[model samples]
Target: MNDNFLNSANAPYVAELFYKYSQEPNSVDSSWRNFFNSLNEDDLSVLGDFGGPEWKKRPSNIIDEISFDKTIRPAPHINIESFKSSTLDSIRALRLIRAYRVNGHLIANLDPLNISKKDYHLELDYKSYGLNDNDLNKEIFIDGSLGLEKAPLKEIIKILKETYSSSIGVEFLHIQSPEQKQWVQERIEEVRNKTIFTPEGKKAIYHRLVESELFEQYLDKKFLGTKRYGIEGGESMIPGIEQIVKQACIAGVENIFIGTAHRGRLTLLSTVLGMPYKSILSKFQGYLNDPNEVLGSGDVKYHLGVSSDREFEGKKIHISLVPNPSHLEAVDPVVMGKVRAKQTQL
Candidate 1:
């Protein structure tokens, strides 16, 4: 047979048909004979029973011939080297995109300090993935539920960059469970199309920042050099904690416990938990000291915990701060134990 058209991809099936024909041509299936006849007519002219001398000269073990072709025949149209290169390129492209999704956070602008940026080789650019400008114009299919039926690669990259490089950084790829990883990805990706916050919401966030800033500045002026453990840089924590408490209340969570070291505890207490500003000021002035009450050396005013009963979305939430030692994260176990005990009581 002329391998110009008939190659190893079809060779095994052809060999099987030839063996059947050699046994009984008339009994052979019509499809098999028709398939053989479809090959170059001129080549079939000189060939005898099995269609070609090349096939007839092979061993009687037709299975062995098919096996040999499967093992040894170089497929005519397929460029093996090119196929391997293409496969490797595809693998690298997949890995490149995955790396961007996983480690883009390493280079993200999450720090409020606006610290010096570090380059993480997320390999976001198309050329890094062996793709070019032309490839960005080509449409590619994504998950159907994503609503974006099909999008250009460039659009996908833009969405990824916008999603990862923002103030929020996603770190879900390290999640072991496939379902959990997918769930996180879906939620994070939803940010791409998430409706913009209303004007009122923006105004509220702005007000919170201003409140945080002014409170810190006031303390700085009133009590100079006195470490009130300010929330100066982490002003966003005000709105963030507010949002969390609001959501927890809406979700019907009865209690919300926050634990933090000296960094911003006082500001959070005064602002979010609604601790009395005069009382906090009195503590700073050493006028709020409990002279009668004693239990060894007491913690700093900022290290003291406070609880408040706040109503949100028509739900009552008991928000409490677990007093933390100067050692960072020391309150975590204490908070956890208290939470479990509370849950037991409930």
Candidate 2:
């Protein structure tokens, strides 16, 4: 009747003996058989409290809560040993999952050049959760945390790595809104934060990259000595901005105001804002001799703002890039002002 007999140290051995006694009474010693036969439903229910507070709160009849494989679940009654083992595994596995969600970004491969070494955190390791290689193959009940109800520790770890520690690391736990945080977690974990593009989509991205590179190359060749502040290495932003425009249009957004410094401004103006290449070339060639001929208050070529309408899949959206001076990030408030003015007009 003493609950201390079923402590963590000997619970597995006792459960094993009880299972053997249930299968064939002669398989275990007489004392073990007698002990097993003396156990009632109440004693069996006590096994639910084996793990931690989470397990302690589980219903006394844990047989319905946990799904056991045929090999582990005995004929007439549940195998208490298997249940205890799985419960402990589930607790450790849950802790591992939470650790990755919180600290997995510490070791993400975010640096494209790989110049800086990543500081790996101990919590991201399986050993930190008291798990070993032997437990990796064991299945644990996760209650659909990562779109899976029950998964092996190895599979869970694989999904966690793919979702949290890949090239794109997400840190959304700091979000104050519970709904927004859960939404972001579910959205990324469901697809492992991978976006699969179709053949046409791939081709479109390739085309954008080619356009961006060609524009930069043309500027470099045309005005050899001029300081253009070109977007040489960061050409991907052209396609990224295009995709943002398309997605925004799809989401009922009709206007987008942008602000950026000299870097990549010409490329964005020509490619994303639909500014004519001839116009940009004319300005670079010093064709604007008179002050009145220059656009946007007679500013330099890159400091000039442009407005254009772009259509994606029949949905039209107007984009406006606010001009900025030599000071970095000076146009942010101007862009916000334009957005506020547009909102007022709407």
The top-ranked prediction according to TM-score is 2
What would the TM-scores of all predictions be?
A: 0.67, 0.76
**Model 2: per-residue Cα lDDT over 1-85, one tens digit each:** 3211223334344444555556677776565455556545534433222332231232334433444332333334435545445
Candidates' C-alpha lDDT: 0.63, 0.73
Residue range with the least summed lDDT across 10 consecutive positions in model 2: 47-56
Each candidate: RMSD:
14.6, 9.9
Residue 101, candidate 2: alpha-carbon lDDT:
82
Clashing pairs in 1: none
RMSD of 2: 9.9
Off by over 4 Å in 1: 1-96, 110-122, 143-147, 193-195, 289-298
Q: Who wins the lDDT comparison?
A: 2
Lowest-scoring 10 consecutive residues by lDDT in candidate 1?
Answer: 43-52
